[model samples]
Target: MPEGPSVRKFHRLVSPFVGQQVVKTGGSSKKLNPAGFQSLWLQDTQVHGKKLFLRFDPDEEIVSPGNNPLSEPLQKEWKEEAGHHQEVSEQSSRSPGGDDAVPSGGDGLRCLWGDTPAGGAERWLQVSFGLFGSIWGNEFSRAKKANKRGDWRDPVPRLVLHFGGGGFLAFYNCQMVWSSSSPVVRPTSDILSEKFHRGQALEALGREQPVCYTLLDQRYFSGLGNIIKNEALFRAGIHPLSPGSLLGLPRLKALVDHVVAFSAGWLRGKFQGRQQHTQIYQKEWCPAGHQVVKEALGPPGGFQRLTWWCPQCQPRLSLDEPEQVAPSSGARAPSTQSLALEGP
Candidate 1:
């Protein structure tokens, strides 16, 4: 699972398509298909948690569910009707029409050109790369190879976003579709933002789940996944089984800061050729000469991913009490302070 930090990198990687016109769009994901696609400018792209959102500037008309929106007379008619109603709505209100854009949801791909007309979307694509899902194409062949995804041409893609510039974005073996625009709460902070500092981490740590589980929660950590979670715990010298409420303010804050800093450094190191290696994510031993142990740490869902930890580093402390471990000399654990802010 790509965590917040990884997703931020993905956002940067896909930015080349921005400002380009959507000459065409198609995908196998039921959420998105042959139904509605047109030429629209891909204005920007963003990631909220693990979800990737591609924003297209609003178009003059909305695509009905069962129609080929780009088709002849129907497209023209929809545009005319949309324009007329937009004019009337604008004249009737002094405020910006709240209906100018519709948000999105679900697992798949979406593409939009610009500011959506009434009852339309501002996104060109709302892609939720489920564990194995991804967006790739001939244009992004090099990127695909870098991600070890073979190549776009190898397995024939189910989704294709054709840009007016003659370039296209492709998706293979991914669930692509259009998400409904709805109002909902999104993750509070992306790991790259200043908003995801010590204060925010402290709030997330206060959850009742074990320390490891709290970090895994997307609602708080957004992009954090099993890999980062495992390595972060080992680095922080904190036990994964420790109850969140039992963690001391200083230790919890330090752990949060360490994870945040590590995430940023890991992302930066990937492109710089800095040894971008994993410490103990899949290793059988710790850097300190201890045999790494594997354990299932979540509630009985049978979905608990494998957790690797060093006994010498992270002790199995009592859940009733928070045990503070001395930060290992070889590890980097930046001390931090809580802002006394409320928890989410």
Candidate 2:
């Protein structure tokens, strides 16, 4: 699965193509199970998370339509701001600056820059592949859809691909909902922002709820996936089985900060604090001269996650550090006992 770094790179690569009208000269991969989308004209070109957003208007009614119900507020915000700009334009004529000072540029926000015909609201229609939807370029006939399983479809779209020439494709766990609309009101005060910055990890997840998997929780860190979780914990010297509540609020906050910083560095193909490359993730062996560890198990969090660590380089940790749970025995458990990892 792609991590935040890879997703950020995708956004950077595809965002420039927004608004370009294209057609599906070819079709999607046959290996991509449920081969629903193909040969459709694409419009509303946009990119969110890593998924590309383009609406396919069929000559006939579209079969599986995906929409972002959460983006309504953002749409409302944009409309209200446009209304405000129009109001300001009308009032400015009465002011001393008059028409000379008020100039309308060709685009909505660009009007303030100079005098030109203001372009009407630029509207775009979008088709999204929720968490696991993807599209490929015309050359990618054999390219696989990132998500074939899971409820990648919305309430309306279980199966059925937009048959057109042009659409967007992305990898596992992209954040398409956030790009659907813009927020109406800008931040008027710093209080809410400060509070959120101080306590962002525990906030309600936008999606992918009812999961204990630390890596999949967007609340803890936006754009993290399985790869990031496997590596980040190893780098931070924490066990994968550690619970969020047991990580302690301060350590959790530190971890969040570390993730954001490290993700940025990783995307740039660099390491977080150290100028050197990664310390241990996906490497041949432990850089610290210890045997690299690997485990494949159905973790308590849910997924059959992979974990890697070094016993000699990564010091043994006490269970009290993460508030270890006692095995299912009829004995009373201690509130603060120091438990040890079994020797290799």
Candidate 3:
């Protein structure tokens, strides 16, 4: 699945065309069709986590369930709330509206577009991807060719996007559509811990540290799939099957840092600069020294995902030794010490 960084990259890749009009479109799942939106126009776009926020001008009309055209009433409510819901440009007069315009009911899959009253139909098309979905753009043809299986519904697409030649293919359900607007939490450390203990990804976490898989828990961070975890571990030289709690503080901390740094850079469309060519994801050879990094698979760590590591470059440590020593039988944890500063 495309993780946060990848989705961020998608945002950068399509930012140039945010205000461009959609000249053509289609979806195998007719349910996702953006019909009846004759006067659609592009507005603006943003990216948060693995999701893309596309703010449209009044030109794009959403075809709600039953083909109920979003009318004037909805538009008025949208303008009133647009300021709170979307990022509006100073040069632009129209607002993107808030929760009101985007109905919370229905099959939740219909698509459409419309035009603003005064603007020259400045269009907005948002292509979003969930945990496993993605934006193919012109690459859709290549994706279709490379993986010859399943219809549109075969994949759990949260939304289907059609915007000119370079469109998006969104994945993942939109259950928590409001997460982007929520207030930020402090410290923000241990995103992995936060996701494992409090969200949907817990079910996905397998085995212990080093051996544990990242995608198993979407909560650790959004958009991680087997591909990223496998490569990241291999690069870090940690064994994939190592217990989730065993990958010492230094290694685990480094891993978390890698994910954060990598995601930040990737989302900004800087993978080439962030990742060394040898560490380039999915490549067969270690670009650093041409060492053949073998693909490891099977019973350990969910086994299905493929992991590659250069034995010469990234060595595995003895499992008998734990990465780091826990504070003590009576000592407080470092995490607790940090949290204590908040109290009186």
Candidate 4:
């Protein structure tokens, strides 16, 4: 899946469409399962971590088919598979701060759009490109339709957003939603941000749990993904499953620093016409000639993701003895990168 930096690129691509009046709107995804979306004017666009949010004005003008221009095209697919009329639940859309919105039930992506606290109203289309999903915007004149499996029809778009002026934005293999409890607003700082919260990162990482667990926690690094975790840990010379609290401050900080640097480097690579050269992720051998080890991990029963690292580079600390200098679950250890590796 494309991570936070990639999602930011999508935001930039469609931001120019802001203020355009939506003439017809509708699409389908295996996960989104949208009922249908009515045409409304576009307002704004935002990117938070790996999610993209599109804002629309709520003043929808429903007109008679005879009087509507492109009435045929607009309604042709809005009712495509019989489930027309996607709506935001009154409870979810109207919630203050949107914390109560549940993210688990429907689709790979979720959105919550409705009345803001100040009485102003807005509807949003939120999307996340899961492992293989891709989003692209093309002109209406060249748009193609989608087949039953969400693949692009000969020349029609997989998802079409027709505007009042005969222009359109076409999407392909993407998941979009308009009702979710997940907050749509982004936090003030993403992990790669200039104002990164070292205190918060440290607090989030200070634990006996696996180091990779904290690295993948959205609360700590909103944009961090599996690939990022592997690369960042390898760069910091830390093992993925090593105990977090045992990585003395200096080692922990090194890991945190690489996360931000590698994240920024990922984006920079795109601009430079290539991606960052990963050392251990998905590889069988490390740069220093050590056999790379792989692990499958996650919360119990969940689908495990693959994690790769050179065990020789990222040595785990022993949890057994007080003589070993491992911190107690609540104790903060002093900074040092030369701590002895735990014996396997």
| Residues 1-344, model 2: lDDT tens digits | 33434433333334333334333222222223222123223333333322234433222332333332213221222211000000001011010101111112332222111111123222222222333333232212222223345423322112233222244432221122111232221111111111223243444221222212645543333345555555555554545545555554544443444444444445434212233255556555765566677775344454465556555544443546543332111111211110110001
Off by over 4 Å in 1: 25-27, 57-124, 137-153, 176-187, 273-275, 319-321, 334-344
lDDT of 4 by residue, 1-344 (tens): 55765655555556556667766765643444222444456666666566666766545443221111112221222211111111111111110112211233344343333222122345556665545333445533222445457865333234667776655565554555664223334243355444456667777777887878777666667667778788878877776777777767777776776776666656544434464677778999987888889889765554367899876776666776312433222112322221111001
- Best-to-worst lDDT order: 4, 1, 3, 2
RMSD, every candidate, angstroms: 13.8, 18.9, 14.0, 13.1
Pairwise TM-score winner, candidates 2 and 4: 4
Worst 10 residues of 3 by lDDT: 81-90
lDDT of each: 0.54, 0.33, 0.38, 0.54
Highest TM-score scorer: 1
In angstroms, give how far residue 230 of model 4 lies from its true place: 0.2
Q: Write the per-residue lDDT of candidate 1 for residues 159-268, one digit (tens) a residue.
A: 67787666777654433334434323243444444444456667878877787877766556666778778877877777788777877787786676666666656655
Per lDDT, the best of the predicted structures is 4
Put the candidates in TM-score order, highest first.
1, 4, 3, 2
In candidate 4, which residue pairs clash? 101-181, 111-178, 111-179, 111-180, 144-155, 144-156, 144-157, 145-153, 145-156, 145-157
Q: How good is model 1 by TM-score?
A: 0.69
All candidates' TM-scores? Answer: 0.69, 0.47, 0.48, 0.66
How many residue pairs of model 1 clash at the backbone? Answer: 24
What does the lDDT read for residue 229 in candidate 3? 62
Give the Å shift of residue 65 in candidate 1.
28
Tens digits of per-residue lDDT for model 3, 116-156: 22343322233443233444344332222223344332333
